[model samples]
Target: MTGGRLRPGTIFGIGLNYADTIREMGRETPTTPYLFPKLTSSVIGDGEAIVIDTEITSRVDWESELAVVIGETARDVPAAEALGIVRGYTVAQDVSARDLQEADGQWVRGKGLDTFCPLGPEVVPAADVPDPQQLAVRTWLNGERVQEGTTKDMVFTVAELIAYLSSFFTLRPGDVILTGTPSGCGDFRTPRMALKPGDVLVSEVEGIGRLTNPVVAKT
Candidate 1:
């Protein structure tokens, strides 16, 4: 894909949409989707580097997610018709800084850091993915499987998210919605796992190819 295709106009992140994730955080399943906006500048393609500034945070975490790429302008769309506006699907890594996320009491900065949102490998047309909910989402740290889950567990389906989001704001072509991640994020592990320089993070969504990026310290 070209840089233009990789650079989306807006990036929307859904939080705690998986049952295991909700249980890990000890929070009730949300009735409505939890949303946050990520800076487009943070996005990178496969094989790119996920740079981390040691001074800013040492608790960086990884979230494997399936991203919905918008194909047309959407407004007040119904869930049944939401997929009509989807261009395709891609893999994404929601690299996060847990310290900042908690200290700041918000997710923007923690989730929007430069090189935090890694997407691509390639976009699989929406039609190609017969049921977004049937796919598997996974993550690997330096070749060892760190996270494993399925889209079938998402609290809100892709169609539901698109419909809900468009109801409040217009979703233009190239906009991306990171359809919340599954369980096994580093933060809630028995011993927390954080990204470190030299570590390779492999994020995958079934059907969409794997998006691999190396973690590096900011020089």
Candidate 2:
């Protein structure tokens, strides 16, 4: 289903899960998932505009990720059985306001802004995607490829993340897990390429679909 019609229950996000990402950010790998929460209100569909309130923060960045869709209610599951609770996969953009993210010393406000999370074209069933770790994830800014990496580079695999999350709370159907994004976010770029008005951001996942959103200033 398209993001416009897909309303998830809870939106969970992972950070520093990719090796390249860790290096780019000059941080160490976490022993466990670095978790955060994104508000469901930020959900937007393909073709929607990712409005940036320039007054709030100018360093709007793009994060391409593989989104996991929960299929059933699970708690304290084992990694081996984690995949069974997945309904499917989709493309998601974990848009961030870098300024707020750093200044607050926490991520909720920076990453949970309205329209910060964009998902879909469509969801590929779990049966269709045989291996989540083998997919390629990418992001494009204004027709330029800014980020490129594979899910295989993820420090925490899909199954591991699911099991880890389920241990603390129940994962219900329609809940989404934004498996960590790979390196190459604008925040780590040499010159830093931030999203601006009139720019377009495209997030894609192999076997899933591409989600395109335009950048605009909040008027």
Candidate 3:
């Protein structure tokens, strides 16, 4: 199903969940953690093209992430029981407008742009993924592998993140929590390599399948 078909719910994301990514960004790892929400409008289906708005943003970067979909409502759930509520997992590309993301001092506008959140070829049932923490997640631009890592590198496990989030608000079915991205984002490159029209991005989670999409100019 397309993101538009999703019911109204919070789209949460964790930032800097990978240690290598934190070091590469030249920032100290967070003591408490960082999280953000994406507008539902930002969600797009796999194989769909992301429209690059060159006039407003020229530095667009791609982030591959594993997304957790909540199956049941959870409030103040304990970490040990957090995974029980996970419905499934899916692949997501957190497309970013670097110039706007850094200049705005906040992620809302830069992250909320339409089609900025590309999710799913299909959601793999949680049962299918026996251990989310043991899976490998990677991203490819065109045919070149740009990012490669495993969930084993995550500083915070999915269960821990769910428990932490539940302490703040209730998580209901259809709610999506983007775990985070690894090192090798386009923005972190020496000269910086941004996505251009025609570039294809594919993110894959070991058992969750791959999400593929091409970049297109917004006309």
Q: Per lDDT, what order, best first?
A: 2, 1, 3
Candidate 2 lDDT over 1-219, as tens digits, reads 643646899999999999999999999889999999999999998889999999999899999999999999989999999999999999999999999999999999999999999988777899999999999999998899988999999999999999999999999999999998988899788888799999999999988999999999999
Per-residue lDDT of candidate 1, residues 1-219 (tens digit): 686238788999999999999999898999999999999999898989999999999999999999999999979999999998999999989999999999999999999999999999888999898999999999999899988999999999999999999999999998999988888888888888799999999999888888999999999
Q: Model-by-model lDDT, in order?
A: 0.92, 0.93, 0.88
lDDT by residue (51-152, candidate 3, tens digit) is 998898999998888999999987999999999999988888888888998999988888889889988878789999999999888989999999998888
Candidate 2: what lDDT?
Answer: 0.93
TM-score of every prediction relative to native? 0.98, 0.98, 0.96
TM-score of 2: 0.98
The alpha-carbon RMSD values of the candidates against the true structure, listed in the order shown, are 1.0, 1.0, 1.5
Candidate 2 residue-wise lDDT at 7 = 83
